[model samples]
Target: MIHFKTLKQANHAFMLLIFILSSLFLSACSGQEQTKQKIPIKDEKTKETAVPLVKEWKMPISISADQGEFYKVIGWLSDQQIFYVTNLKQSSHLYLYNLITGKSKLIYKTENPIVNVQISPSKKYLLIHSSPSSNEGLVTIIDSKGTELLKKTFPSYDLDFEWNPYNESQILVTKFAEDWSFQLNLLDTKDASTTVLHFPEPFIKWINKDEIAYLNWNRNSPSLDAPLSFNGFGTEGEKTVFANIIQFEVYRNMLMTVSANKQDKSMADYSFFDKKLKKLFSFSIPQLSNYSDWLVPFYDYSEGKKQFITFKPLTSGDADTYSEGFQLIRYDLVKGSSEILLGGLENVPLSVSPSGNAALMGNSFEKIIDLNEKKIYDLKRND
Candidate 1:
């Protein structure tokens, strides 16, 4: 999901943050700030609600602000174990922490700071990415135990990866040069062989077992939205089924998209569809008038709860000018209703826990949210 080839990047911190997050959702840590904003609710249905925390504990990690060291709460390896990384300038160490035992095991170590770390869809393998040069990247693939399986390097200025949910051993990797020239390869980890996948777009997600979808942008024409196109692995040709799609993401069984609302160009429509490409439902968020340059906010979908959550502002405005922060919203896919959960926080990245009970927030993963309890707690070093 993190890519830097677009004209929109322009050496912005937000663009860099998005890329770092997309690279296997590299995990975060720091002196936790409790600067949560208590913005007033517009309606009674989505008003503020408070509940006492049932459980509270420090995250088993620390940060050295003096040294500019940081960390990320990458994701939950299991309900009890969290996968994280301590990032220093010269080195980075990946760890798996067990909440029950309050212990962490070193998974892997790299000489350069880890830029990205990803777990396979089934949680069977780990992929760590590090940048050793401006145009070269080193990748380390390991099993769940941190046993090295493969290490490869790519000559790319930017990169994106998609783990085939149906085929855990096969990975789709796209490598892009500084000029935005790119190549897509289907990697067979078992044999170290790659088959060139001729795709036009750099950002593609597996829509189903064999089919992949991408925003088919006509780079020459440079339109605001692209056709959401699809192609199968064994098929020769491609098909453009939907139009005017700005962004799209595919999760376990849910396919999501962001596009300018057909009825109102000022609103960005968020829609969900099944693997069959059947439209499920959609809602809209305020979008800037210039749809082409609109920077969509961060969002994460919870597979277990069938919930779509994102940070959104109440009013549409310029993307970067808003210092007031956005509200956290949860759209229930099953119930077809939405609720405001939290508000007045920067547009930072967030990932939902697999169980859908908690979420880790901030670039450093400095805050933890109790989704069920409606509370946010600082995530700090246990010591």
Candidate 2:
């Protein structure tokens, strides 16, 4: 071939070899650029951002003690005033502390111990309850000035009650019947009048001052597939709102429900409905490896923001160490993304501020996170 090839043929063969080499070189360079781009993205995803440290406040002298300890935060009445319970010298007392003044006032004192305390929405009344034993308890309504308005004794079995959010004068109470079924009643605080409703498996919630919504088991239904329904009952009469519901919750003005899936019993469709039971949006969450992991919604229905908070475990171990504990994540519904607020919060949050800007957390110490600022403050006792 070397002896017989013409000049033109040799030139053509040399150009063909050059074209092949050029293609290979270009491909290799492009692949290297792509690899370099991918590595930075992977690194960015894995990098952990440092949690910012904000201002720390000394635990007001009111709740701090050397011998006794503060129990749990009841709630925040205002940005500066907080309600909490404490046990000192074998007696429990409710105390209201002012953050600005660094002073605390005794709201109520008791020797039997305050089991739970719920403040009214107006912050004028406190609903206090205490259980003498496992089977007996008493509910008392007291003003912020410690004036008793109403006190009633209730049996410990199947006793559940909720205050009417719209009207402080009324409350919805539930008790178990002899057959282990639950009964719902509307209680009037002025005259102690109770009107029993003819609803079974009643989970009552006040939609407004004049309206209420509840979930009931549909025993009259012929099909087993749709055994539960959500209903609105009041002076207007009872009307079925939604059906085939496995779980439902009424938060502010929005209704959230989980519908049962016929094909896959383990799966469910969670939907948000309006007051009229019209579906707004729907989604499904994945199965959790640990059932104890919490997926909670932090929606400000008043403002109509769709946000949620989730607690995810970092490991499969029993005890969550400092470096390997549960993570607190704030998720945005619109963006479909999540941001880690805290990496190793050992315990669930105590309370989220009404404005949703801060959360109280800690086990042995008191820590407050300014959720909006992404900063945490360690609260210390001012000695």
Candidate 3:
């Protein structure tokens, strides 16, 4: 005779397995579509073909052109301005386009690809740095009119660079080798004289002109994938553990460090800090997938207004399911509430609008997502 208790236990286990499998199946077959084919609509006025805007100003890229015909938009100065880097017959050039005008103008052209382009806080000057072709990386400082103010060369190869907003002469360059180290250099833009303030590890970061927030790398039993890591300043600063440290934003007398952590297998933790290394508040994501990449942080500083720090995680995935995808999250540090601005797609964070309301990001598939509207703009060239 069969035992009734064992039979009941087997039935319950079978039901649990079915429930788990059904949940996964539904998530995989969700309504999210990843189509790269062109969806055409007739322009009402010109009688030309145009792709339908899912939301206002959505799908900025042309949906019918060949790969080389599409402008590779590299950065966004504001919501209204976009910068594109492209090569014409192997000669690299930079163009700034006014999105409102729908017109593009050449800004600077060089023999090499523009690796990094930075605009000053005042919007008066542009710093253009190109990869090293012969000597060290060359930096050219030019005004808005494309007039070259000064040109200089730094000793090491750099992939990342940022300017000090307060002191235009001071610049920070990231040198990547076996590990990430930074060289803080003070430059005389007139004479191009440079003095380097060497900082150890990948922790060197600029908060403002007078102050720099530095993080000390953990050396004891190092694990790159460790859930927590220590950060401080130059062998003496207060030690803080963070899962992923994106950036440090300074407003008034307070300093804010934005970081994220993977709490468990699925949940993630996001935190912001004050100047005294005190935690103001922490946000968490409970059901996010783990196949995410780099986090891009955007901070806004306006007095008496709620400050927001946005985190955009890069991801990779497939058509049937989200194999990997990035989520854009905005944290209102004052109110301590986190909003998932955009999610459920693959993207690489390019730039955020100066007003902190929108951002422009792209994926390998040539799709751009506007975070503020929660819409996907097909950047795929249609012409």
Candidate 4:
């Protein structure tokens, strides 16, 4: 029942639940800038801009440190804008905040706590999640303009999504239950149509346009490793691609896997493979025993820069007690070089900017890293 090593289950949390839904909230809306909030002068020359009292790098609309931060940043839409989640009153709201303009626009709002918000691979659409109950999941797909495209509810304890790299309109989803029962389906976002894939594995990732790979594990006999298997999208198939692999992820046409070295249990090897599953390269990282059993470090992959990035601790130790912090390391595939982007930070959830120019780190995304300037800025601070 664990997906991608493990999942941190929020205790009986968050939803915008409806049996069936669409166009009901903001029916058939188009993309447009908000006319309310700030009205600029028609004659540009007549408008005067005020000078700032704080550093230019601070958030346009700041949240206080005492409020128990709720906002979780998704990522940067552009250098000046970002998408993040926070609750307003009893309702959860997604906001598009402009760093330069000091404007925050309501993108989406719901009475239920917004469980998750993810942008499409092309950055053209968003996938939002809300669970109405312990066994139900509701998904809302919208455009960058915040216009709702499709919405549906599923009978699931957990719902996982893997967006198709080749087709932004298609998605592979796994609906899970409390008892570890799951159903995998290929979903077409355009029509809300789905094709049920008859596969045994609960976790899967798209290997290519026509094939998908998954960690095939024995339910009856659990182990530290699983067989990496591949199956064609349209065919009923079975093929073991690799063995003794802990985890795998696919970015565009490249496949990456993390497996334990036979000779060393305390170290992990990351292997990169092309579309054909041919090993292109590999590297090693010291593993924290906290990540010892079934976990990996906070990591992200950037296809734009062909880099594998991770928050590596000073040394392999208990992941729970290690306060020495971590180094934000980036391994470049093209140049075969490793660079430390940032250091002296705990291993929190790492979300890199789409342009690879910045990263939001720490609880509530309270810390921001200017990847270009090599500067770290505090988003929320005590005055």
Tens-digit per-residue lDDT, 221-310, candidate 1: 987888999899889889987888888888877788899878877799998888687989899988754435667888998888999889
Q: What is the lDDT of candidate 4?
A: 0.75
Question: Which candidate's lDDT is highest?
Answer: 1
Worst 10 residues of 1 by lDDT: 28-37
Give the distance in Å from residue 66's predicted Cα in candidate 1 to where it truly belongs: 15
TM-score of each: 0.80, 0.64, 0.63, 0.78
Model 3, 339-368: lDDT tens per residue? Answer: 776665454544456555445655322454
In angstroms, the error of model 3 at 196 is: 1.9
Which regions of candidate 2 deviate over 4 angstroms? 1-56, 60-68, 176-183, 217-228, 232-240, 243-246, 258-270, 279-284, 289-307, 310-327, 331-339, 344-350, 361-367, 375-383
Candidate closer to the true structure by TM-score (higher is better), 2 or 3: 2
| Each model's lDDT | 0.79, 0.62, 0.54, 0.75
RMSD of 2: 15.9
* Colliding residue pairs in candidate 2: 59-380
Better by TM-score, candidate 3 or 1: 1
* Pairs with backbone N, CA or C atoms under 3 Å apart (clashes), candidate 4: 289-292
Q: Please rank every candidate by lDDT, starting with the best.
A: 1, 4, 2, 3
Question: Is candidate 1 or 2 superior in TM-score?
Answer: 1
